[model samples]
Target chain A: MGNQRDSIGDSSAHNIYLTNGASEGVRQVLNMAIRSKEDGIMVPIPQYPLYSALITLQGGTMVPYYLDEPKNWGLDIKDLEYRVKKAKDEGLNVRSMVVINPGNPTGQVLTEQNIREIILCYENSILIMADEVYKNVYSEGSQFLSFRKVLNGMGAPYKDNELISFHSISKGLMGECGLRGGYMETHNIDPFVEEMFYKLKSIELCSNTIGQLGTLLMINPPKRGVEADEVVDLYEKEQGEIYGGLKERAKMLTATFNKMERTSCSEIQGAMYGFPRIHLTQSAIKAAKEQGVQPDFFYCMQMVNETGIMTVPGSGFGQRDGEFHYRITNLVSPTSEMRATLDRLEAFNSEFYAKYSQ
Target chain B: MGNQRDSIGDSSAHNIYLTNGASEGVRQVLNMAIRSKEDGIMVPIPQYPLYSALITLQGGTMVPYYLDEPKNWGLDIKDLEYRVKKAKDEGLNVRSMVVINPGNPTGQVLTEQNIREIILCYENSILIMADEVYKNVYSEGSQFLSFRKVLNGMGAPYKDNELISFHSISKGLMGECGLRGGYMETHNIDPFVEEMFYKLKSIELCSNTIGQLGTLLMINPPKRGVEADEVVDLYEKEQGEIYGGLKERAKMLTATFNKMERTSCSEIQGAMYGFPRIHLTQSAIKAAKEQGVQPDFFYCMQMVNETGIMTVPGSGFGQRDGEFHYRITNLVSPTSEMRATLDRLEAFNSEFYAKYSQ
Candidate 1:
């Protein structure tokens, strides 16, 4: 059952449906819509692969909008309009826009104003799929602004816009990725369509019940007495430890990247990832091509070989032409180990550039 | 992770993958294989909904071959070849065959010889997708013989046949449907296809870990010391209780259905269900058409309304033309309540037949 929206000043959680996981929730909702290749869904470039993969798996066209790097990888309405119109011009029906706030890989949280600008752009026509799984991960300055809250902030008719916001127990402090538990909350959907969604989900009978209980434990935890206080106190203490540690690591890593010869990183506002641009030399790009790999991939592989630190290539997420980037996690435990990894990365980059530079 | 195939005499479980459930395991494999509408998969008539639902969702043709009802819902190789040839004649690429042992809805297990004929028919060409989730549920006389065992019994050439066998903790004594735990073991599959499958599964990252542990506990339960003996003793005691109760219910329900007017059920060999064929009059069929419902659906709905017992219509499980049936579980706890329900069903059938026997 889906009643998770009331706090956002919309209808209650009665519109919420538990999914197999965040990915499954996204897949089921997209599977409910996106009938043919004629229909397109907007996704962020350098997005989580699940979004793009499911789109192709469901036989729908993916219309990608790049996150603006200068603006700290924030959504620019211009890019949205460009991608939507570009897709429309090709005779594709731009039925939905997928907005992953507190972005994956990039790790930038959306502003309330940014959310408003997004909703207002296609409030009436396009369905908004907000992947708000990282909403609970509070950042340094920006508090997580749910799309439902921003939609409610617009008031009146904006609340009537079709939205399916997904939340999960997989991320955040719980980090129960293997639990495979998440939920989808829908707003302003027709009762008939809602029933249809229920029937569609029933095809697999139901999502994992234990995962549902895990989500329950998450939303409704021990809160009051000695027992409650003990659990809550321990949870908050860990949160504090991780928050302070991760925030410092984010700053140190960004500074470390900028100090490097051809590396620069945008701020890590929220989420667990830090996507840093690695400026590749022409000769390095040539070496990558000769190895039949993207420059960033080749560079990341070499870094992994040398430093024993794994990273995903920027091309894996989807970067602009001629731009090179790599995503690393803020999840590195033991501060010294993370610092050591960063130090090795710096050394490896210098060696790599010297070896492959023109 | 997929090393569960060793006990069954397959090459190894290195070719295995974990899934959300038996259904999801079946789905991922089918989704990987069935690429276009022109591609066909051989499904048993009156098969579980998962096969058809996924086949349609994955945009593949479902070519159904009927089971030999008189032979206790046994496999018929001629029917299989007929369906396959028909699909091929219609220009469909018949890529694979789906064999649900301890057949879902019907609840009949395949004989070792039956399994041999099935493999021998398509061992060279079509891939075999064996749903053996109910392999542990022993019947009155027939012990559950896995398709893998039969394939091995056929020796080398058949051993080289491509097979994807699925098993789950959802059925058997665990009966943890909502737990969502299962594994798929592939035999003699091409390495290229296995890599593709790994990439596809990587999209969702992993299945429910708690369920995975539950599966682990099932495969490697306690055996030696005091605590281990106590746990094992309790498990065996509960299993014995369920076994004694369920075996009685299966016999009772089968006899009950046979005694009822115009109703017949095959032996409840392995699975939890007893799919009974209900003979509907022509007038009832007309009435069902007037109500804009399938005849079996209408009959099952009426049965539910009259007896407060729910049964899934045969049409829901892909029944043959002109025949009507409904699938009900032998899981009605307490033999008395089941008998009372059966008595109510008998009375309802008499009254309905009196009214609709045109």
Candidate 2:
């Protein structure tokens, strides 16, 4: 749990709070900050719907800023500023921003420069709730950097910025999500806000004690050459294969989608999913409206109907208006299954597009 | 999962919704039914803090109906009706009622007739959220009865009552709280309400899959004469010992608390706790007020400070005006430790009372 603290040079363990999972931590932070309709949080467009769902559940307005899907799904500082101002103009009192690194659905690892800019962007009143569950899953060219690390490195007021960042054993090499284990560490939060977090968790009776123990074992695994050499070797070997396989499959899928006549996919820089934008024909859009569903949803439903494959529509995850994309995981097992999915997807794309393209 | 379900004789499993734990199910039901300050839920006074905490978190007004502590903490029907009318008069739209049977903190199990009457008392609009996690742990004279069973047993309008009753592997014979597993079954819920439940759960990406699977195994254990017959016998043997031990301990603690000079404890009809109301002196109340805390809180904190004993304050669980009590779990491990706790509590009571006698 102190792993994040070590990364950012925290002097004490007081900052870390173990949660039911990353989601619970996220809920607590959002719940603590957003007290009424006036409060809102900025979320990345095409985000993990958990963000949108939780915001709605907590009655907080979700102000979305579009990611630069054209540029490997990079953060667009200008777009985010526009969203903040736009939301304020609409009578929303925006208090926080949520940044998912190695983004869910988007699968983009943010640059260190981008992170620093995000911290410098928000005022002291706005807390940063960073969803870094996929921090350990970056692509080859990108390295996972903590918002805390970036903020601390910048020095001064940036170092003391209010930030609640999270990590999970559910993701990463461990993949023990079934156990529901995760931790959140805050950076320089006010004592009042800190007390509320404690009070909230005390009510949940401390988020399943076993999950916290599972996290402890994960963060402090048995040392190599200290009576666990064989275990360590096995862990390293399996972890290498999983990551290497994910990166390879992600690349294969993105390339395949890009090659399709009416589709383009941003690079899968990290995380498990690839979000591929589909160029829906006018007739397909018309057909979707007749069926009373979003175009991307209709497209995904068609693929599922034909090839027995399921993908989530962009609309379900909050996307830019008039754009259609679907999110698919790069985690298809038995390698051959992955190849077959791609083959079926390629065939379905051409066949379906030809039917409606004219 | 199929247990409260069996109580209602549901041919389909549509009613059952597995949750992260019983708390999650309870949270979801309350969240779905109560959307604003105009919405309120009738909760038992001296109830589980989880109900109070969750209702407060969701911004739902808690209309507390006092229990008859002298009558084995019996549900006072007239009192509940009065509370409901009062809340309505105050402009709160009370839409649901929470029943923590084998009550938490109170530890009183309602009879089947009581359960049926509760359903009849509420209009069609008021949903019933039954916290039956302790349904299987009734005292010798009491029998655990599901709200679903009572409702259906009456037939017609009663059979179609909107009810969400919870059960957990964390309680009963399994005692797997740290693993966090439970299920909630809805009886004759409107399709719209059912859709809302599904939508809300979909956001959390399905509660701890392992917990749900744990529940599935718990509900469908192997037959006695099956291939795993020996394992089944062993399980029964262990389970019997656990139950036998709990019953004995609960009996011993209730008697002990009653024997104390200034304390009286209601029967532990179900659940794990023995909530003992302590008669405090005027001086003690004054001292507590001087410290700026609830008298019960101050009393419990003093006990902790002096004797290293921790118990939940009655005020935390919502007690009658000016009454002081604290809750202690009867599930203490090791017979000797339980005895020591009892002995220490007895001696501390007299010593502490003498100090504040003036």
Candidate 3:
């Protein structure tokens, strides 16, 4: 227990609250953090829909910062500064910034410099909620770094800043989303806030012990040179194969999407998804309006119906005005099926553009 | 998966969202049902602290009704009626009432007629959250009926009333508090509210799948029969011995507490606790005030410090305006330790009262 608590502290100075999943953790913390109508949270524009949906449910304001699409879907420090100032100028108390690293959808890993810049911009008052659930799944050359480490290195500006970093067994080598285990580590938060969090956690009594046990198992791991050598070796080999498969498929899909007409896409730098930007023609937009849906949503729905391929629309994730995109996961199909998925995407795009584009 | 969705529908129709544990399920539905400001939730005075803490954290108002201590800790419909009316008159919208069966601390299980009478007090507009976590643990002659079933039998005032009945693996044979799996069944909820619940559930994504797996395992017990006699018999014998041991020891503890001079203790009914109401003397109360804690909280702290016994304070659970009490779970130690715990309690009570009574 002491070791676990120490690990938690090593995560962030504040208390660690475990949850059923990072999704539940995010929602609960967001609810706890934003108490009043005047309180708002700022998240990246191309963020996980979970944030906006939770913010909407909690009746908190959502301020958004657009990722720099031309800059490999990277965070623009200027945009973060602009949004923070904009929120304050508009009389919204922007309480926190939500950052997902090995970022979702865009899958861009933040540079150490970028991490420092983001922390410096926060002004030591607004808390930073760094979602590092995909920390273990980065590309071969991209080593995962904790925001805690990032802040710890920057010593002076961030030592006193409030930060909550979330990690999950579900995404790591475990690949066990069904396990639904994750923990949040908070740093530099007031003891009063930690007290409230304790009450809040007790409200759930505790997270499912099975998941917590699984997490404990993950953390402690098996002893080195233990008896079950073959079992351990097989588990490691399967994990390596899965990782290699994901990386290759991610590459292929990104290249295919980019080659398509009027379409833009990004490589999966770290996370599981590839989000491709699609430009719908005026006729398609009109048709989508007639169908009472966003063009991309309508397009995705059509693709799902036609090919049984499901993708979340950009609107689900935050997007800039009139910008359209759809997220596809590398986990969707086996390698044999990927060719079919690509062929279908190419067919649908050609057909959609032929009828709608001038 | 289909079976799970079907179960969800069955539960949703019953106004139940199965949760990671009854603790979490209770929190979610209660938060959904209670008022975050002007609305008050009526809980049994000397109730579980879980309800009060959650209500306070969610920004809801809490209205308390004292159990009729003279009537074997049964619900005093008059106290509830008075509290409800008073809260409403004071402009607090009393949204729901929480009834713990085989009461957590008090350990009193109500009769069917008593349940019906309470149900009659709250009609269609107001909901009742029935915490029947100890259904399977009742004494042989003690009957346990679902509030939903009882209300259905009554067939008039409460026939169409909204109710949520909760159950958990934490309290039954499993005693698996760490696993955190439980469920609630709902009845007579509004469609829009039902839709809102679905949306709310989606916000947490879902309870951890392993917890759901536990729930599944619970509802459909293992099919291992006489062929697997050793395993089944071992489980059965262990449970029987544990239950038998609890019943015998609970009797001993309560009998000894009642014999103590300033203590009024209740008999254990169905749940795993024995809440002995301790009457604090003037001097003890004065000393407690000087120490700056509730008399019971002070007594509990002393108990903890002196004996290394970790029991919750009655003040943590709500109580009548002037009454002081403390809760002790019967699961203190093995059968051998029962006499020692009783001796400790008796001495603690006698000395505490002797010092305080004047």
Top of the candidates by TM-score: 2
Report the C-alpha lDDT of model 1 over B1-358, residue by residue, as the tens digit: 3333335533445676777778888878888999899999989988988888888878898988999888889987898878777888999998889988889888888877788888877635689998888754546568777666666667778877888888888874648778888888887789899888888888877889977876766555555574567787987788788877778888887888888888998878878888989888889999999999999999989989988989899998887799888988877888788888888988999998998998
lDDT of each: 0.82, 0.82, 0.77
Per-residue lDDT over A1-358 for candidate 3, one digit per residue giving the tens place of the 0 to 100 score: 2133223345433466777778878877897888777898989979888898888877889998989877778889998899889889999999988999888888787777788888888765888898888854545556666677777667776767888878777876637887778788777888898787776776666777778877676656544488488867877787677777777788888889989998988666778888899988888889999989998898898878877878899888878889899999877556668877888878987877887886
Candidate 1, A36-135: lDDT as tens digits: 9999999999899898999998899999998999999998898787777789899999888888978998989988878888887773557899898874
TM-score of chain A of each: 0.94, 0.94, 0.91
| TM-scores of the models, in the order given | 0.89, 0.93, 0.90
Better of 2 and 3 by lDDT: 2
lDDT, candidate 2, B54-129, per-residue tens = 9888888989989899988888888988889999999999888989888888888998778877878866567888
Name the candidate, 1 or 3, with the larger DockQ value.
1
**Residue pairs in collision within model 3:** B14-B186, B14-B187, B15-B186, B16-B186, B20-B180, B46-B318
Q: What is the C-alpha lDDT profile of model 2 across A7-65, one tens digit per residue?
A: 74453578888887898888878878887778889998888878888888888888888
Which of the predicted structures, 1 or 3, would earn the higher lDDT when compared with the native? 1
Q: Tell me the TM-score of candidate 1's A chain.
A: 0.94
Candidate 1 wrongly placed segments (more than 4 Å): A1-6, A12-14, A136-140, A155-159, A190-195, A221-235, A281-290, A334-337, A343-358, B1-7, B136-140, B155-158, B221-238, B280-299, B334-358
Kindly report which residue pairs in candidate 2 clash with one another.
none
